[model samples]
Target: MDTFHFHLHGDVQPLDRFFQNCIGSCHAYLTLREDWREHARLIQREIGFRAVRSHGIFHDLVGIYQIPWGGERVFNFQNLDKIYDFWLSIGLKPFVELSFTPRALASGDRTVFHYQANVTPPKDRGEWELLIRTFATHLIERYGLEEVQTWYFEVWNEPDLQGIFWTGSMEEYFDLYALTARTLKAVHPSLKVGGPATSRNMWVKEMLDYCAAHNVPIDFLSTHHYCADAAFEMGEFSGIHWRGQKAMLHDVQRTVQTVRQSAFPNLPVLYTEWNVSPIHEDVYGKDSEFTAAFVLQTVKDLSGLLEAYSYWAISDVFEESGPGLTPFSGKYGLVNLHGIKKPVYHAFHFLSQLYDEELVSDAPSLRVTRSPEGNVRLLTWNFVEPVNPDFHSDYPLSGGEREEEIVLEGLQGEYEITCYQVDREHGNAFRAWLAMGSPQYLTAAQVEQLKQTAEPSVCDHQRLILDGTLRIKHVLPPSGIRFYDIRRVG
Candidate 1:
């Protein structure tokens, strides 16, 4: 048994709400699918994330570029319009990732991902500039300057990955950034733009120095972090280092400290892509309930460290490497393909219900907050990292049952306590699917069953504060997450 204590009179502060700031998705082309739009609408309606980010806005499928049989290259916005219009209608702003050179404008035939996004730099600098300017001008024309100004224009995705993401030299990337930034800013100085959207938190210092010295236009700094990533330096004296469980937190902290000490202390920072592991086939996050606890742990610790951290995706309708072969194919999405909500989805749902103000508590795994109406909300979890956590190899999570006793002092009224729990037997659709023999294809009935199983098991009751102390007890299974809401009773 473990006991945690808190007093209602502790220090209070504003809850950052960084977890719901933005969510990630597959390439923008996927947004055209009915399933994808349904997922987006459901996520927005339930969790209410402010913005959505994805890759390949200029990819061929979105029809941004076309070369007629008898004419020169032309640009089209019909497909892009369908995508962004749906997002806006559903109350989501695009975080706008400017990416993957159009095949007609690419310097080479190099490509990446299952859909084969052209990774080569632009064939001609002037042509690239024309495309950028035209794109910005068209956006302003369609969405109006006021609406377009609210979106972020990130230069590219993981250009630091070199041959995989950008088949160009470091200097070439810097050149591209300068060209794109200057062109967008020229269209409208108020448009928000940023760059060096590198993986593993690379190139922050150099990017800041280069932009400052060259007088480039950059409104913010954006990068990414994954706990299982390997950190390294690019040029001379380069080396690689393996990260541990706390890697994401440490990496973002290092990036923030570096920026604060540099010339861009006041610049907003965003981890535009992040998750437990970067591997697409990793079930450590997919099928396990542990991911929910992992998300809560990291996001709570990341308060005030960054402006936004976009989870790599919203649903497993993604197909970067390729489409997921099964319902729970270890892909990085809060919801599975059948629209079944994973445990991580519940984690965000619980976090969303928390009040704006936070009350102090000494326990590392406990959060206590109160609303203006005198309702008390508490969230607590028991987390255990997977042993060795191999993305390809399935691993079992091990831990004993945890009994938690929560005692709040100086309360003297009747209150209603409602508990929502997620563990091995609660709010876990993957586990339910497995119990049904891990079917390769599910019937309509099975899908409906799984959806029902995905809901958190909820319990409620009313009680009077016993002698000015309210004591609540709960039993948490391994890697379990629980949320409690206590409100005054008439």
Candidate 2:
């Protein structure tokens, strides 16, 4: 049995930048798809993401680069116009990841992802600078300078990874960034831009030093992290290394500390991509209670460390490798291909409901916040990452139940208590699918049934009369999360 003690405090703390609101996708081209757009809108309405970041805006798929008949090479904004317009329509600003060398501008044929975006360096740096300036100018013209200025213009994605995402050396990437950043800033100084968007939280120091040395503009620092033990080797689906939540938090803190000690101490840090496991093929665990717990734990730990953190994806419409075969194909998404909310989706949704007024708690597993309207919300979770014998298992390890006696002090009057929960048996679509015999193909009826099972189960409302303190007992299974909303009534 575990004990958690919480006290309601009169002191109010500013709400930390909870990174649940910024999310990412595989490619900018996907934003043009009807299904993708539908899912994006659903995420915006449900999860409330403010900005979306994705790769391959300048890739050939978006058709931004061309050498027309007898005319010099020029930029095209047709597809870009459609994509940005759709994002704006959905109330999401772009965290534009300027990436993937366009084929026409590439010096070599190196490429990545299922879409084969050219990953080689530009054939002409001068032309690259011109392209960037023209692109920025076009965005300002179409979206208005005031509006476009608010969006992020990241130089490139994961340039420090070596040989995989980038075909050039580290020095070359810095040069590329300088050209891109300088050109964009030259177009409009207020247009925010930054990058070296390296994977596994790399290259912050080097990027900062280079930018400072070269006198390049850096409005914010951008990078990514995954809880996986190591980088995923190319051409392999090695499953998840599963480093767990504590390790992920340590890395995030280290990254933040590195920036704080750097030449640009006040520069904001944005985690352009993140997830529990970077492996996109671990379908079973990816959609399970374990992943949901990981999400809750990581977000709580990252409370004040980031300006924004975009989850790797919002929907499984992603196709970096290829289209997912099943509804729960372990692709990186908060929702499945059928658009059913997974347990992790509910985790974030519940997190979004937390208020600005923070309360003191002795338990590391509990987060307490009070609304300005005198409502109190308590979020608690039991997170246990799979290890040793259970690490290779497709399903989450079960039966680590925690019984906690929660004592809340400094409370008076009658209050209404509403609890929303997610565990192996609730708000978990993967578990529901398993109970349905792990169906590879779900029928319409089966899908509808799973949708119902995927929702967060609500406990019956209870009224409590508190003279000075309140006590409640909760039993949570492994990777279970419970959110309690308590409001005073007459």
Candidate 3:
């Protein structure tokens, strides 16, 4: 049994900005798929993510470049328009990863992903600059300067991951970033541009130094972090290992601190890509109670440290390693291919319901907030790092459930308490799927049933008359989260 105390007081701090409102995907060009579009709309309507960030916007599949009979290259925005229109219609602005060199502009044959995005730098810097300038101008003219100014133009995705995402050296990446930044800024000085969107928090200080030395504009700093211990190399799944939550928190904190200590101290930091594990094939890691707990823990730890943080993806319509056939195949998405919500999705949904007003709690596992109307909310989780033998345990809740007694003082009135919980037995569709024999393919009715059961379960409402002290008891399982909303009664 663990006892915790929350002291509700008038003193308050502004809630951290919803930095997690941005989410990423490998299917940026899949906006044409009806199911994909529906999934995007559902995520927007439910979770209300503000921006969608993804790669492949400049890939040949989108048909952005053409070499005419005159041996001159022309850039087209017809497909780009369709993609942006779909996003805007769903109320999602583009975070805009300007990436994957179009084949005509590419310097070499290097490529990555199922669709084979060109990983090479442009053969000619000036031509690349023209392409960027033309694209930026088109966006500004179509969306209006004021509207486009709000969008983010991340120069490239993980340029530091040489030989995989980029075929250039670190110096070359710096040059590319500088050229891209200068070009985008040239189009409209107000256009927000930033990056070196590196994985595992690489290149923050060096990027700042390069931009400062070269006199290039950097509106924000961007990078990524995952809970895995090391970077993922192609064909290296067997070597993957969990680094635990503490390491992930330390990495993020250090990354933010690095940017803050740099010459551009005021620059906002956006973690454009992040997840519990970078190894996409680790099915259990992606679709488990541990991931949900990791989500709650990560957000709680990194809340005020960055301007924006995007989970690696919104849906599993991804195709970096090709589309996953199984529903719960350890893909990097909040929702599966069938559009069923995972535990991590429910974690964000719970977090979205919290009020901005602050309430004090010393426990690391708990977040307490007080509404301006005097309502109180407490979100707590029991998190166990998925490592070794612990990872082999099918149901994390089996022996790890613990009783928690929460005591709130300085309360003088009657209140109603509503508890929303997500654990192995609640708000976990993957676990339910396992119970149903881990079906490789599910019928429509089965899918609907799982969808209905994939939400956070609400406990029976409890009303309490408090004189001066309030105490409530809850049993929480390992990798479980509970959000308690307390409303003062009239």
Candidate 4:
């Protein structure tokens, strides 16, 4: 192992907490479920994400648009109101994804997800426009115009996936977006709307061009990206090394450059969805401690490059293809189905505790910040990107032993030092579940055990005196994440 040194000077700058701007949920219909609400409330209370985004807002299951047998078209928002109201009650706004066409208005029976969200474009453009108007009108009527103005009405999810998420061509999506954006604006001029929510950062420039040419209103440029997308872009299925572990960061850098050079240079860029991999069964990344480092590394690297980078989801109450076969199945969520907080959950929680002022540090992996109350906080991670990425493999992501030494040469003082950490041995629920014989299903007692085991370790709590200099050394395991809270003891 080699030691890396950092001299903290207490120099600070204002920081933007962009990571918590929004969080991704499974879908709109799932919001009605009790488990989903519980997860939403927990994430809101702990991480305090500003808004929640999901697919299938207009799915038939949500019961938004309906045409009864031998009857006329009708729009109902009672159920939608419940979902939105719950989000507001918990200090969250909706990052509304106007999605999967309702069966009544869908051009075809085509659908996606196990919940079968209709993916086709509207059969009748007029009817679709009417639905969009009614949806926006009902929201404003319920939540008030002032409150609704804070929400974002994203046009659709991954329209560039074509047959999978959209049965329409690029031109057709542009038409739908134009009509929907126009309709939402007509409902209330102050309401915000934007789109081209395509995966792999596709169709952004084209969408912007189309919107500009057609005089369409687009308030922001929204898209999705994952580490796997970077890998795919590099034409590598066996592995990804675009910039070693910084592949995702490089991907965002390129996208940001593209947006900056485009006609919509000042447009708010939102990566509405992102994660280590897009695979639902990605055990190596999603289910292990690897995700904590992956998250911390990406968030640090993408500080000012993006407005919002929403992680794929907050909980494993997801059912895109169906339910997970086992308790620890590689579902893309920060918390597992039983509500056990994964390493990624604690990663966000650690970030939430950071103060607004960031202290300058020499290391790329270390972040130092000071609170108004005089407490100093440090976040550091050891990220080990996988080689020949294999999601199904049970192999651990730990690469090698790494060490760091820090010499603080600021004022001499007594301080209380506290630390929280998540690595293979700490805050990793999957490993604990595996230790319990990797049960296919969990009992209430087993669930409780896992929850307790999944908590990030709190260690190094002590009062120490710094005499002109304080030297600290750390030997971090691969994919490890740690946060330190230091408060001056007067």
Candidate 5:
């Protein structure tokens, strides 16, 4: 093998939970009522995330009593204590989205697609504001204001998109955002308030402008993204590359640049609603495993460029009803609707384990590996399975069989390298699940069984020495992701 650059030391810290839709949505879709206990237990014990972005609130397309939009299944969160209990019991901090106007408050003519979104401002702002107060009061009464305040309060979903997400204007959004922000701040000034959660970089500009002109408080910013290609469908992938991966980070990069240019240099940008939409295409069955590795790489590569990023959803929710879904509602997710963990979920778990710092040992040529010294715990996974951007589609993607090496340079002397890999044989339970076919769904019990069995097996490979270094060589597995736990044994 060849040497790369920079010795890696300290580990990277884990970000909070990645946001998704309703907890009830995931619960219903994932658990067979009987297995709810085991399902909740297994999921809660899973060390991946401590937070979740519950989707489809405040947008007014869905009612408060009903399951929020995005969830295909209609669930009544009417028993506030019941709903809150479920989440708290599972050990989750809600990234609350102040959302879709309830039908009762919606303007007579205002309503959107499947969600029946009421984009029009409430006919009675007082009533609507009261509703907000009520919700907050309930949460505080249940979870305590101090506890609930720990949650995020994003004003609304993407209002910048005219047709689908937003029927309101920038000015309207500013008004809504300001009102929501003030309400939250007034209720508990320490509560975080930042949103205008629009898509593909829409609200950043207007949001900043509004906050600046109006002097509103923004704790953190949130947004969303998807692969830039829309031409293909259902596995028709042909020419897709990890370049889009770069594009993912680049979008944040540009946002960061622009923010710095505009004097909001310290503003943190959060990718709140991303991944393949409609909740099925990008993730699900067989196509989502190798994305496991991509998950690690993408997050690691983009960590510096973003403050926080969520992978749209944890599991596919019930809002995926075709009857109500518009032209392109089939988005992607890290996991699927079955409650079984996707490769991406596993990878996310792995990435989350990385400590908050990265230190690379200074190495020779080959820009891949970092120096062996430092406090960072290095976790680099190679996706033997190409991370085709058209990841979930039915067509062939831009990656093919190939050979590559990442040299860890700048080793002072001998070092102990432990490696763990997830591939067809190790962590590819999805492959087995896929064989079960579409109608194939796992009960929470079955899902739990799989989770218990989903541990990675490690093997020791040959070691080489050069200029005070050690090299490990092995064939990267098919659709495999190899993680190196590099430590100094000298």
Candidate 6:
């Protein structure tokens, strides 16, 4: 079998305390009237995010756009300084979006989705260009061009869909991008800006070709992919178990390779929006267990090619069929809005748990020893699902409850191997909730219980000593993944 080594990339989000832990924006942040600093502190505690993107910084600016659920609460320049200060305070940067026309500048009353926040682009080309320039100047003046130069400013959100989110044409999107890119660069020149922030490989070719031809000041390439029901409808895969997972990844791999060949050789691919499923139906994360397993394996596959990957939004929200809400339908959340951490969150947690040690390329199988102090990690997958009908994670998993047989070669004495796994029962936390009919809502106390159960079961698997490479037969089932800690016995 072909083997590959990977950097095991971690997804960045403000929804948790990871890395620089910068807090930023969300659809909910729009509803509050809280002091900016207070909001910033809350973000610091909750999201640990590194960047903030305003929903409508460069759109029309006249009549108000109605937010279907919250009424007319989100649009206001009064909170600009407050928002930016809190952003810098938490040490997170801005991923500014030049988007959704403000009602004031919107040429028509037609809005995408329902909120009316989906303002149409400026009817007059000059008016649209002016909006971009004004927004650009405001940023340079407030944050100072030098400091603001570091932020990533994307043009808009998913312009390719063009129904609820945008009522404009693709040609219009390109024109908007070119105008916005030029204005932002002209103001700071050093500021990083790019977009085509559409989904499922939209505009990659046109955007890349356009930038190369017009010298449109492109800096990075970004898009999204959620194997929601709609995604699979676009592409076909072979199997539903292990092969299904490989097939899922195969599609992503194909997209990346295509970009490299045609337009974006130097541009980095940033999946700004992605998750297992876009909406909730059976399980909060429908196929979350599958996504959890794919998380680890795909990182092993795409870490080198992809730069930054952020899951769609932090929490769950009302996905109604109206305006001002997420234009597309589905629950593309990393964590449920209730703040209950889901399996997807934990999968990321497990990936982050892996150490960035120099890998042994020739090592054929997964190897790892458990315990924070232990120095071994062994990783392997059954490319094919485990046929062992006896294996399952029933209740609280303990040390001995997990058992399997494997042949180890090049061994002289006994050794210890620590094991960790994400299986059908253990890794499918979201499904567990679903099977139980989605608890009348898990409380803080109840959430603690679930978090504990979701963690991996680790224990030493006998003792063995080996001098040369060894091959072993082992059993790992539950339709997911597992790891082991191997150590030389004294």
**Who wins the lDDT comparison?**
1
What stretches of model 4 exceed 4 Å from their correct place? 1-9, 230-244, 395-398
lDDT of 3 at 364: 75
**Model 1 accuracy (lDDT, Cα):** 0.85
Local lDDT at 345 for model 5:
59
lDDT of each: 0.85, 0.82, 0.83, 0.82, 0.54, 0.52
**Residue-by-residue lDDT tens digits, candidate 6, 287-314:** 3454454455544544445656665544
Q: Is candidate 5 or candidate 6 better by lDDT?
A: 5
User: For residues 1-490, could you state the per-residue lDDT of candidate 1 as single tens digits?
Assistant: 7887777766788888987888999999998989888888888888889899999999999978877777888999999989889999988899999998998888899888899999999989999898899999999999999999999999999888887889897778888999999999999999999988998888999899988899998888999887765433332112222255577778888999988887878989999998877767777565568788888888888887888889888999999879888889888888999889999999888888899888865677778888877778989998765665556654455566778899887665778788888987899998888899989898999999999999998855556654567888888777799899888774
RMSD of each: 2.8, 2.2, 2.3, 2.7, 7.0, 8.5
Clashes of each: 0, 1, 1, 0, 69, 49
Q: Write the per-residue lDDT of candidate 3 for residues 1-490, one digit (tens) a residue.
A: 7897766774667777555468887756877777788788877776788898989888888878767656888788898999999888888899999888989889999888788999999899988898888888988889999899999999889987788899889999988888999888888799999998998788888999988888999999989887764645662434555676787678878887888888898898888988877766777678988788888888887767778889888888888888887888888888999999999887877777778876655567787788767788888898875445223334223347768898887777889989888888998899999999988899999999999889889975888888878787888888888988989995
TM-score, structure 5 vs. true: 0.74
- TM-score for each of the candidates: 0.95, 0.94, 0.94, 0.95, 0.74, 0.68
**Residues 112-202, model 2: lDDT tens digits:** 8899988889989888988898888888888898899889999888887666788889999999988888898899889898987998888
RMSD of 3: 2.3
lDDT of 4 by residue, 346-398 (tens): 98999998889987655778887777766678888888766665567654443
Model 2 TM-score is 0.94
Error of 4 at 308 (Å): 0.6
